[model samples]
Target chain A: MSDLTQLTISQARAKLRGKEITATEITEAYLSAIDRANPALNAYVAVTGDKARDMAKASDARLVKGEGGALEGIPLGIKDLFGTEGVHTQACSHVLDGFKPRYESTVTSNLWADGAVMLGKLNMDEFAMGSSNETSYYGPVINPWRRSRLDTVVMPTTHQGDGGFVSAGGTRTARSLDNAQLVPGGSSGGSATAVSAFLCAGATATDTGGSIRQPAAFTGTVGIKPTYGRCSRWGIVAFASSLDQAGPIARDVRDAAILLKSMASVDPKDTTSVDRPVPDYEAVIGKPIKGMKVGIPREYRVDGMPEEIEALWQKGIAWLKDAGAEIVDISLPHTKYALPAYYIVAPAEASSNLARYDGVRYGLRVPGKDIVDMYEKTRAAGFGREVKRRIMIGTYVLSAGYYDAYYLQAQKVRNLIKRDFETVFAAGVDVILTPATPSAAFGIADEDMAADPVKMYLNDIFTVTVNMAGLPGIAVPAGLDAKGLPLGLQLIGRPFDEETLFQTAAVIEQAAGTFQPEKWW
Target chain B: MSVDLQTVKRVARLARIAVSEEDAKRMTGELNAILGFVEQLNEVDVSGVEPMTSVTPMEMKKRQDVVTDGGKAADIVANAPATEENFFLVPKVVE
Candidate 1:
């Protein structure tokens, strides 16, 4: 029982199958842990304890009868962005706070079919916009790591901050002077924090840009953003529709592999979801990447990357080199254009996708004197500042006058960025390696985002390239920074070649060793 | 490159979100900074090169032209914020 909390999804399933532990027991333990820790972490936005208990009890019954699902008895937290039938599926925004759905998302339905027990929905940025979870209507999630008490307050600063903050949770009150609170990373911060703290074995996360991967890196976990349309985006709350893909965030590569297999499926409900065959991802785990070609994209070198991150990246290269994988120095010359292209293209799509949230259709609505007033008042109050900024930018780019200059030019540049990968893959590059984020997690109140918006956007420089090229990118925790916060190495793969990506990432994982949660899990 | 705060307010209105005047000023500076960061693209020599839109050159997959649907129009309409007699209700846009 003491060790059950630390077991990965695969280990838990093995134990459950052997009858060493009942599903009921596992579910109960997780519920209790949630009760104990969730108050301080603020990871979950909603807990379906009654529903999970019922499901777990049935799974236990089935296991007793010699019928078991692959992931039967495993408790998992789902991001609130995924629509769940008969459950509130708010995207952690005030607009959709009370909105419940009549149907479940395709991803949730797929996970259910795999016999995963629903723990609850985790919190996220308002419509998945901010890098930090502070923009979430639910409030900022506290990191689970215990650090020496520092003299600080957790406030959203102008630029990003590195120091931890004060927790509004009772644990903070009880041990107020004992531990320091750090940023939990976002917009999938809750998912990252929850998994890191062992609230659940894994969680469902969506990435439009780097929402899933960046948070995973920041929180010291493994998160994979599969190729666009690899996982159906049917039930995901739309951010930038073409860019949004739901994937798994877990403790290790194997867990992520298992969860991704369970979540990917073809659905007629979503026109964009591919009808390709879901691979047996478990079979692909731990494969040797010897003799494989890994590309080190020459363009990812920014002007002032910290020496520590640069060293860790070199260390990863050393490990891969030792494993007999050939590291090719490749050039993604169009890399510089990726961020600009993404900013234009993502906003254009987002502007169109987010138009549905008008006062007339769905999500939030505020009554006003007239229809125009209603639309104005509802949107004016419903969306957050970042969302508004993005929407404005998106609309501006896609507008008639500026369309060619911003949107069309961006699309043209997007193709060039995509070509960078195409040329590399054509030249025998299997996977591309880069830093997950420009730097490690910064403090929530370190800088005013209002003042330095570009510095804030620069955080996604290493990430947005993959999205622009529509390739799979996974972020695995590589090492710690000068301030002791975790940094991550990102691996980008050719479309639909996740097996190579996973195998190569495992090689890095083998070298770096499994992420040992220092007091979080 | 200097964007007026009034334009920021207009953009905010079009985006359907509220932005404080202070936020507008901050966003202008930030937007300018981002534009400056993106300006590095001009240094790359990509003359006569076709911009790549997708990593894989696979064309969009074809589907049957026959119409198919979940037939849950009623359920979808039920979820709409404003509906009237099985139709999505909107403010009359026609003059």
Candidate 2:
């Protein structure tokens, strides 16, 4: 009766089990929504229409037999970083041009085995490098949420160069071209955009230094980056092996909890995947955090952080305090160092991991005079400016003379940052609370961020610490900014303690009701 | 920590990615800006701190040394930019 794409995973699951609607019906609703929205949003890079329908058809049959998984019939978007087995899985980079993997990512396979239907591959920052989706060779994903209260001032497309950013599904759309779009935060921008825009019921996203949570905060959705080893990274394109973890971006914390349960697992294929039972995250949803201790780290009070963001953090503390959560002031002195450390560490690993795409195997290749020249040309042509900058930074930091100064120092700083979290958590802190981003979403490729790329890197200042500490963190849409753009509050939990985050975030979400952008698309 | 144009070239060569002279000049500034930011790590006293490799305390996992997967060369090479005889094709390495 209603547009099924707007239903949360839990809501859709109940309706499917009650036989009020079939899986095909809901999947169709999402597909139709994508058809209408994607051209403007650039949220989906590849739409697996036939595969989705086939999965839904199978799900419909299973539902009739009274057998359905937790997410049976839920149409979800998979971030392009995840290998989807014969579908596009390029990590939204041109170097990975037209390359589709023959095997599914362990996280997606886990989602599939539990009956989640893939709507398509979502776009992202190339190799999950940047804070805004602009790094994506496919162009930036337009966040559905606009700057409210303004007469629509349409600006012609500015960044349309050789990227072949084909909007409107390979055809130009007037509305998209005319509007000055705001960026969905990266590197999980498309996933956040799709989930927030109701294009997908949920999305599988990865966070290598705040990719998932930052984008979630920007788009006003719930995103949780599970503990580093909680989800097997076997098939998810490797970024930073130590910091990268797969997570879910969904309409609400409950849906994030449900999706995360199905996405996390132990796998022998990945040596780093934790050998432990994946907890039932939904079981703790809505549970009272009566005696929970929430820590507010004094160190997170960085210079130049907006007055509104600080107010939001204080308001989040008040909400939890009202809900019986004990608010305690704590300090993570190494918090300021997390971003610099993450930059050094993430790219260092990215350079090593991305070296695999040297024209010898897969993706784009530009021929040259000889093998050495060919490698140089292929990578030069394949990678975008952001990717190249990172590769250069990574190579420079890990160079023979600079290894200790940059790479090793970053690793040491990482240890200190992790120690700060461990010290706080050891003080009986149940969870730590902070603003998700310095501010709400900015306009795509805004002059400020583009002038200095580090301005973009500063977007992850709050969220990157979670990755550095190897802890589970969730961003809950707390309220709106002065401009009516959604702002999120992040809750950081102990290692493998996602249940606490889910329960705590639910309280924050309850006090601060869910938000969705006006359907301008 | 300031990156020079020559250093950018050396690193680009090391990374095996072609950097045009002009782009290399641009990269020198960007790379220096990033490095200048990362130089803040020098402020922390990490004298005794071990450079952490693994976030979770786990040893290197080992399995029985055996062929877990093979015979999927057809599928594996499906994504190759160029291939011949089921192997990825590249420019000739030997003269």
TM for every model, in the order presented, reads 0.89, 0.95
Please report the TM-score between candidate 1 and the true structure: 0.89
TM-score leader: 2
Per residue, candidate 2 scores C-alpha lDDT tens digits across B1-95 of 79788889999999999989999999998988898888888889999999998898998999898998899989888989888989888777776
Off by over 4 Å in 1: A146-180, A448-450, B18-74, B77-95
- The residue-level lDDT of candidate 1 at A355 comes to 75
- Measured against the native two-chain assembly using Cα atoms, what DockQ does each of the candidate structures obtain, in the order listed? 0.42, 0.77
Name model 2 segments beyond 4 Å from true.
A150-179
Candidates' RMSD to native: 7.8, 8.2
Worst 10-residue stretch by lDDT in candidate 2 chain A?
A169-178
lDDT of each: 0.80, 0.90
